[model samples]
Target: MAPSTRRAYATGERSFTCYCQSMNRSPWPASSDLVEDYVTHLFNTGIASSTLSVYLSAIARYHVMHNWPDPTQSARLKAILEGARRMNGVHQDQRLPITPDLLRQLHSRLHLTSNQHIDQRMFGAAFTLAHHFLLRVSEYTSISPARFNPDATLCLDDVHYDRTMLRCTIKQSKTDQRRNGVTLTMQRAESPFVHDVCTGYSEIRRLLYPANFPFFMHASGRFLTRSDVTEALKKCLPDSCDRMRYSSHSFRIGGATAAAADGQPVDAICKKGRWKSASFQRYIRPFPNT
Candidate 1:
């Protein structure tokens, strides 16, 4: 929770304290129906579900710490959780990657229709780099312009020019096993479309973020969050499109799907994605109808 959320929780605690004092009674036990009612009140007042979950989890821990004998409280909480789960409804199915034609349509709208000459251009460059180069989102942030050595052959500066042979050392990836690990090297294959995107991203990196800092920083000079990237992609997509269902993780999915379509081996795709085990084969199973 944010500071305001924490403050609201504190205010509720103060009210509970005052109520207990007025009644000349000790704090309510977890088994008390009153505590359960308070949780419902919090939910009714439009508190975020994640915030409420945190508060309830803390309350549960406090009860456990105090050695409260509250079998009834546990039962009540279970019922409340089940009710909330039902009310929230079933989750939507995962949206697959936007096809190449749809992706081109999105690009046209963002590049031509909108007056996004500067920010949108940079945004387009980022996603294009992600989609085309199979670069992990973190790779952009982990790389730094300052890391470009005088030798020019060891860093991003060296290989970015030859699009066919681009390489950068990924220090920590989503699947890196060791606390400290060797760097990952990625090379662009034979697509001209992919080549242009990587070339454009190199230029955009210098234009948007400081050459002295991380490769992908915001206008405020802070490193971009994965959510920030998703929001930008959302804007680039058409209004009629349900691209809000897409996330930064979708970039990886898009890459995997594209590679799979290109007849890349499942093992190779898994290695690129840094999956720990072949169990990810579950995701590769074709839909029954498809």
Candidate 2:
């Protein structure tokens, strides 16, 4: 699983474990009825609907993994999900993506022009890849520095490439399925820029670590964590800025949004992103119509 996904699973597991412990019960050997009871208990205790939803979803997954039936199929489960309504005092607000101009400004703040620094090099690679390739942080992190040629160029072997055209073969995706492969033919203005950022990132890693090291690592020399990337983004941008949610996955969104704005075909964008289905359109939502 990707780091972000791992974090979510960890959080869910912690919540489930805590809830079970608080009830003076070991949930490890729980049955479907116990899961349903837990979901009901959450609602009766006035837990927030969204939070209860997360907890329930996690429990459901746990049950499914154990070959137990889902709570939703049970009468108690259905009631917990749909019968109870939110209190009038609570309002669920939908969040929106950051605007393009703000993103551009954020990008500028992250990549300084004259002086070069280690942190800058790290963020620059992350920001540039997200800006162009619509890459998930996982995709960037999955790439090993050793994969690059001696000149620091991506060998273009993972995907087929002509003199100016490239076809990316995504063997595995976030959804845990193999994509049918994608081809990208960069325009004159874009290819050089993408190549330079990728090369510089490889060089930075090579300078800091011995040959055959992971592409990105912490001061402790372990691979960089999702939190590391988030902290770097937060540090690079202004303290007061709140227009963007700015998770590592934002890079994937930024890529899709930029491609859509530039009039790339939706089919091409979908292939490059390795979205298993159109359901992913929900994640990108509507890009700047301009």
lDDT (C-alpha, whole model) for all candidates:
0.53, 0.56
CA lDDT for candidate 2 = 0.56
RMSD of 1: 10.2
Per-residue C-alpha lDDT of model 2 across residues 28-91, encoded as one tens digit per residue: 6566676777777777787776676566656665666677665545666666566665441443
lDDT tens digits by residue: candidate 1, 86-164: 7765344475564455456556766542353554555565566566545556555322322321221122332345645
CA shift of 42, model 2, Å? 1.0
The top-ranked prediction according to TM-score is: 2
Clash pairs (backbone) in predicted model 2: none
Highest-lDDT candidate:
2
lDDT of 1 at 289: 16
